[model samples]
Target: MAMDTPFDEFLKEWSDNIDKVRTGAGLLSKIRDADVDVGTTPKTLIERRDKVELFRYDPIAERSVDTPVLIVYGLIGRYTMADLQPDRSLVRSLLAKGIDLWLIDWGQPGRGERWLTIDDYVDDYIDEAVERICAETGHEKITLLGICEGGVFTTCYAALHPRRVKNLVLTITPIDFHADVDDPALHRGFLNVWIRSLEASDIDLMVDALGVIPGEFMSSVFSLMTPMRSIAKYNVDLIDTVDDRDKLMNFLRMEKWLADRPDHPGSAGRQWLHDLYQENKLIKGEFALSGRKVDLGAVKMPILNVFALDDHIVPPNCSKALGQKAGSKDYTEIPLPGGHVGLFVSSRSQGGLTKNIADWLTARDG
Candidate 1:
């Protein structure tokens, strides 16, 4: 083929630019029309109180489980992201797979509850919720699926009651926060340099005023870790998929989840940063919550460590390393190709993470 003239090249470039602009405009239109689903799986809020709310996801077809699975979400985002939409929800997929679900919804905390700690959130709230689940399900043991920071809580829960947790699953969890001190993803060593000043400045005051950690603040932190990717990558993609409704809905649902900020209780937020991130206490087994020391070695339940290859928040090493430290004979790790958030939303991971979860649970009826 003969090479095109410079004028022809200029025309092609102009046409591509126009297409991008049109695509972006169409995307914004669809985004505004779509119904954002920040609500979680089909469940009713059975329990609600200050800084804590519990939900029950009714089994799709009469649950056959001798044990119920409770999903613990991270402090960063709302729980419903797992069940973003009916079609693309992790909770919905689990329901279809016959895994009875229970979710912990820590609704926006109030000023009165601003002093809550990880100890309070995990021990007073989560521990009580676990008991409630046991009473409701009539099962002495329950399966735990903890994602991100929630996994840290679940680890403590399992350690406290080794026999109570039949099977334990940790997804995109950062047990070894100190893994890569120099790696920007974990922010283990370097983050501390800024935390003291940030906490002493407007950021701390901002949380104090709001009573919980703001989603916007957390999002900004995530952005700083990967400035170009978080800031520019999405806008560029938005311009290319304006007319694709399904793609647009996916984008909007995610954007909604991203914006639906959850404020972290001040006390809990401070302890988390100081103890876990700054001191790296979890991996060293020096962490204590609820007046008792937490040891990962005590987590002897059958463990499944699921991690995403591209997870910037909780790197693969952070999650995959759980299996080795838990000292569980039946420990397993499932590595999928996606990021921290993508693990819940990515199409490719849906089949693998979803099916594997059911099979893994059913296979181990401890």
Candidate 2:
């Protein structure tokens, strides 16, 4: 055979690329239409309120730790992401480590819930759930693990009822809203910049008009934050792993979680934006859960603050501030290396971050 010409090589390479695209399209179709099962880690519903449900995951190990963990997710997202898939599940990893986990599923809000405020969430729902978990586990105080805005709730609860929380864990949670205001490195944090840009009247008008912030609206905002994410990342990533079934499914599972957004209650949304985002009341010790001021100094329980170094939704500075503000004598701030969602599902986080949480809890496990 004659030596292959440059033109021949170029044609062959182009043809190979075309074949990959065709294969990727077929895989994408299956992902779009296939019935994919997620949040398969078994959990039992322990309690239910209007739209909130408390789910307790059975221990995968023969025995569980003395103190249990209660996972509270952000209001705008489903808790299912914590247990998205067996292999990539924070819930699974914790359970396998004998850590009993109870999750709060703040179900989709309705028109009636529009009047519900953080007072209702923290004083009523979260308190009741904590009581239920304590009763079940025969432990007076449970480890409070909060994710994102849920972290705000837990922090409020810990301050209000410090005796009820044995150890507090905040993952990608913002403690000081204005902590990164002067940090050029964290200027890319879209949520921080976007919220700060809005005037108080603008926030009030939006919440008042919508009643509840539409889940679709919030999801669209998230998508717009990084336009290339919606357009380029998926196409490039899918192509890279088009022939790999497991990788494609992994991607599809994450997409499913991101799409599963929940409507935030109007009153709560108004308070959150105005008080925490706008006024920076949380760090200033001016935030009120119901009628009482939430004092960060009351967070005396052993605390673990896990923040992603590359987080844009809640900048690392916002999360790291917990170490300085909380009253915990044993406060630890873990600086991770990813964005908000990546902490739970990314390959870099598979065993690393989850193990860190488990070990931290275990060290203080009574």
Please write out the lDDT profile of model 1 over residues 218-316, one tens digit for every residue: 778767876777767576776656557677777788878877777777778877777777677888889988768888899888898898887766767
lDDT by candidate, in order shown:
0.77, 0.86
Deviation (Å) of 19 in candidate 1:
5.5
TM-score of every model? 0.88, 0.94
Residue ranges of candidate 1 with Cα displaced over 4 Å: 1-3, 6-10, 16-34, 61-65, 182-211
Q: RMSD in Å for candidate 2, one decimal? A: 2.0
lDDT score, residue 216, model 1?
Answer: 71
Q: Score residue 307 of candidate 1 by CA lDDT.
A: 86
Model 1 scores worst on lDDT over the 10 consecutive residues at: 187-196
Model 2: weakest 10-residue lDDT segment is: 28-37
